[model samples]
Structures are given as C-alpha cells and as structure tokens.
Target: MNAIIENIDVLLSGFLTTLGLSALAGFTSFFGGLILAGFAISNNPTLRKISMLYVALMQNIPAAAHLFFMIFILPVLGLKAPFFVLAIIGVTIYFSAYYCQAVRSGVNAIGRGQLEASRALGLKNMQTMRLVVLPQGLRNSVPPLINTTIALIKVTAIAGVFGVTELFGTMLQLINVNDSAVIALMLVTGIGYSLITIPAALAAAAVERKVAFNS
Candidate 1:
C-alpha cells in the first residue's frame, strides 16, 4: 500500500501509455481490417489473394513474435524505428487480421438476397461491396470488434516485455524493488486493466443489443 501510494504517478503514467498505445493500434487496425475486408470481397483475383495471404500470415504468427521481429529483427535490416513505434506497428498488424476476420464474417452473414438485389440494380461488384456490404457488415461487426478490442487491450501487456513501460512493466519494476508489495502491485495492475476492458465489454453488450434491435 505504501509502495503504491508513493508511486502513484508512475502507475498513472504507465496506465496512460497503455491507453495511448491501445487507441492508436485500435484505430489503425480497424481501418486496415476494413480495407482488407474490401480486398477479400473484391472481384480481382490478385486482391483476394493478397488479402488471404496477409490474414493468413498475421493470424499464424504469435503477437509477441510479431513485436519481437520488429524490435529485434527489423533493426538488422536498417528499418529501425523507436521501440514504441515498432510496438504500435506490430500490434496493429497482428490484431488487424482478427479484425479482418470479424468483418469478413459479418459480410458473409449477409443474406444472398442482398447481393442479388445489388446485382439486379446493375451495381458492379465493387459498388455493391462499397455501398451495401460494407455499411451492413460494419454494423454487424461492431460488437465483435469491440470484443476483439478487449482482447487487444489485454495483450498490450506483452509490449512491456519488448521495452514499453505499460502497466505490466510498471508492476514488474515495482515488484523488483518492493518485494513486500508484490501482491498489491499485481492487484492494482489487474484493476487498471479491468478499468479499460470491463467498460468496453459492457459497452459491447449494449451495442449488440442496439444493433439487434435496429435490425
């Protein structure tokens, strides 16, 4: 308790860093996923293949490995950036795959009738996807994407291992020096994570209900 009380500023700073990382990664991943979903549904064979390959590679790789490659491997290739920037890139890429799936699944869930209707109106494949599929699919995807976001936020803890001083990193640093407050430090850190995840989770449910009600 004394340790936490004294190090309140440090804990807050770590929590804020985690928030910043999550926000940047989340927004970019959402955009990337949307674009990839478009690619997946495109008429062009090359675009479809590119989408498939990207999602496959990202999905198969472990998130930590993605970050590790950027943090360690990329520097060797002279593609160096700040460790924090590398972490954002790694997280965005890794989670965008999952977001892509969430979107693709939503698009798939659309009734065949919708596609037929678009075609009957002389809408091209790209136009149908842009004006119809994406709008509907994105709405259906909201809840799942938010759930994915919860998972993403939790996984940001891994970034600490690669040099980001997020909440978990703060806990580690404090525990090493304040062995007696280890349990308290851990509890507080867990609470910090819950503060973000719990509200997002609750909001997911509300959004799900709203979407369902509207549909």
Candidate 2:
C-alpha cells in the first residue's frame, strides 16, 4: 500500500498513457474496420476479395508479431517512428481486423427485406447502405465492438515490449526496484484496467438495451 502511494505519480502517468493509447487505437480501428466492412460487403468482386485477404492475414498473425514487425522490420524498410506512434499503429491494425468481422456480421444480420425496401423506395445502393444498413448494423454490432475494445485495452500491455512504457511497463519497472511489491502492483494494474473496461462495458450494455427497445 505504501509502495503504491509513494509511486502514485508514476502509476498515474502510466495509466494516462494506457488510456491515450487505447482511445487512439480504438477510434482508428473502429473507423478503419467500418471501411473494411464496407469493402467486404461491396458488390465489386475485387474489393470483396481484398477485404477478405486482409482479414485472413490479420486474424492469422499474432498481435505481438505485428508489434515486433512494426518495431524491427519497418525500420529496415526506412520507416521509423517513436515507440508510442508505432504502438498505436500496431494496436490499431491488430484490432481493426476483428472489428471488421464484427461489423460484417452485423451487416449480414440485416435481412434481404431491408435492402429490398430501400431499393423499392428509390434509394441507390450507396444511399441504402449509408442511410439504412450501416446505422442498424453498427447498432447491432455494439456488444461485439465493446468486447473488442476491452480486449484491445488489455493488449496495450504488449506495447511495453517495444519500450512504449504503458501501465504494464510501469508495473514491471516498479517490480524490478521493489520485488516485494509485485502482488500489490499487479493488483493496482488490474484495478486500473478495470476502471476503463468496466465503464465501457456498462455503457455498451446501456446502448444495446436502448437499441433493442427502439428496434
């Protein structure tokens, strides 16, 4: 307890970094996934194939491998950035694949009747998708999207491997200095993660309820 109190500043800084990384990665992945989902559902065969290939690749690769590639291989190709930036990019891309699938499932859940109704109302394909399909699909996708967001937040700990100094990194540094504090530090770290994920989960549940009621 005293150890945590003494190192509150360090813990807080690390928590803030974790929060920022999760937020940046979460929003970027959400929008990117939407675009990918659009591609997956497009009438154009080439676009569908490209989206399928991307999903296959990202889903098969591990997140740590993605980070390692970003940290090591990208530099060999003359692409370099700060560890924080690289971590963001890695986490975003890693989670976006799952997000794409989640959104795609939601889009698929919409029945043919909805599409036919839109077409009968003189809406073009693009307009029908934009004004009708995507809105409901996104709503239906909230639970899975929230699950992905929670998982991504936890995965931010992997950023420490590349020297990004997020919450897990801070805990590791603290543990090295005071080995006796390991249990306490880990407990605090779990609490910090809970602070973010629990609220997000609650909010998602509320949104899901509202969506169901409206539907």
Candidate 3:
C-alpha cells in the first residue's frame, strides 16, 4: 500500500497507456474483422479464400512473433514506425483474426432460410447482407466479440517487450527500482487491471443476457 501510494503516478500513467492502446486496437480490429468476415462469407470464392488464408495465418502464429516481426524484422525491410504505432498495428492484426472467426460463426448461425427469404423479397446479395444478415449476425456475435476485446486488452501486456510503456512495462520498472516491494506492487497492479477487466466482464454478461432474451 505504501509502495503503491508512492508510485501512484507511474502506475496511473501506464494504466492509461494500456487503456488507450487496448481501446484503439479493439476498435480497429472490430471493424477490420467485420470487413474480413464479409469476405469470408462472400459469393466470390477468391475473396473467401483470401480471408480464410489470412485468418489461418494469424491464428497459427503467436502474438509475440507478430510483434517481433513488426518491430524487428520490418525495419530490415526498410519499413519503420514508432513502437506505439507498431504495437497498435501488431495487436490489431493479431486479434482481428480471432474477431473474424467470432463474427464468421455469428454469420453462419443465420439460417439459409433467412437468406432465401431475403432473396425471395427481391433483395440483392449485398443488400440482404447489409440490411438483414449483418444486423442479426452482429447481435449474436456481441458476447464473443466482447470476450475477444477483453482478451486483447490483457494481451497488450506483451507490448512491453517493445518498450511500449503500458501497464506491465511500468510494473517491471517498479520491480527493478524497488525489488523488495515486488509483492505489494504486483498486488496493486492486479487491482489496477481488475478495475478495467471486472467492469468489462460485468458489462459483457449484461449484454449476453439481453441478447439471449431478445433471441
């Protein structure tokens, strides 16, 4: 407690950075996933294949590998970005694949009957998908999407490896500065993370219940 009080500023700074990175990555991945999901379900075989390949590639590789590739390998190829930008890009790409799968499952859950009915109403494929399918599929996907976002938030800790200065990075610094206070500082870090994740989990549960009731 005393240690935490003394280092409150450092903790808060890192917490806010982590929060911002998670939020940015989450939003980018959500939209990017939606785009990929569309392609995955499209009538065009080529687009579907491309989307599937992307998802498979991302899922097979670990996030740390992706970060290392972006931060270390990309520079060799003459592409460079700040660690902050690279972290967001890396996290977004890594998580977007999971999001794509979650959204694809939701889309697949919509029955062929719904598609047939939409076509029977003289709706084109794009129109039907935009107006009818996406609305319903996205609702079904809310819970899993929320879970994915939560997982991504936790994964931002990995960004510390590239010196992104997020929550885990700050904790490591604190540990180095005051080794004896490790346990106390770690407990406080856990509390800080809980403050974000607990609320997100509760909200996800509420959303799931509401979605289930509506269905």
Best by lDDT: 1
Residue 35 displacement (Å), model 2? 1.9
Which residue window of length 10 is worst by lDDT in model 3? 206-215
- In model 3, the Cα lDDT at residue 15 comes to 94
RMSD of each candidate relative to the true structure: 1.8, 1.8, 1.7
- Please provide, for model 3 over 1-215, each residue's C-alpha lDDT reduced to its tens digit, 9 standing for 90 to 100: 67788989999999999999999999999888988988898899999999999999997899999889889888899998899899999988888899999998877778888889999999998999899889889988888888888889888888876789899889998899888899998888788788888888998899888877332
Q: Which TM-score value belongs to model 1?
A: 0.93
Model 2 lDDT per residue over 132-158, tens place: 998888888887788889889999999
Tell me the spans in candidate 3 whose CA falls farther than 4 Å from its real position.
213-215
lDDT of each candidate versus the true structure = 0.90, 0.88, 0.88
Candidate 1 clashing pairs? Answer: none
Clashing pairs in 2: none
Q: How much is 139 displaced in model 1, in angstroms?
A: 0.6
Arranged by lDDT, best first: 1, 2, 3
Give the Å shift of residue 134 in candidate 2. 1.9
Going through the candidates in the order shown, the clash numbers are 0, 0, 0
lDDT for each residue of candidate 1 in 1-215, tens digit (9 for 90 to 100): 99999999999999999999899889888889878888898888999999999999998999989989989999999997988899999998999899998888877777788889999999998899889888888888889999999989988899988889988888898898999999999999999999999999999999988877332
Judged by whole-model lDDT over C-alpha atoms, candidate 3 comes out at 0.88
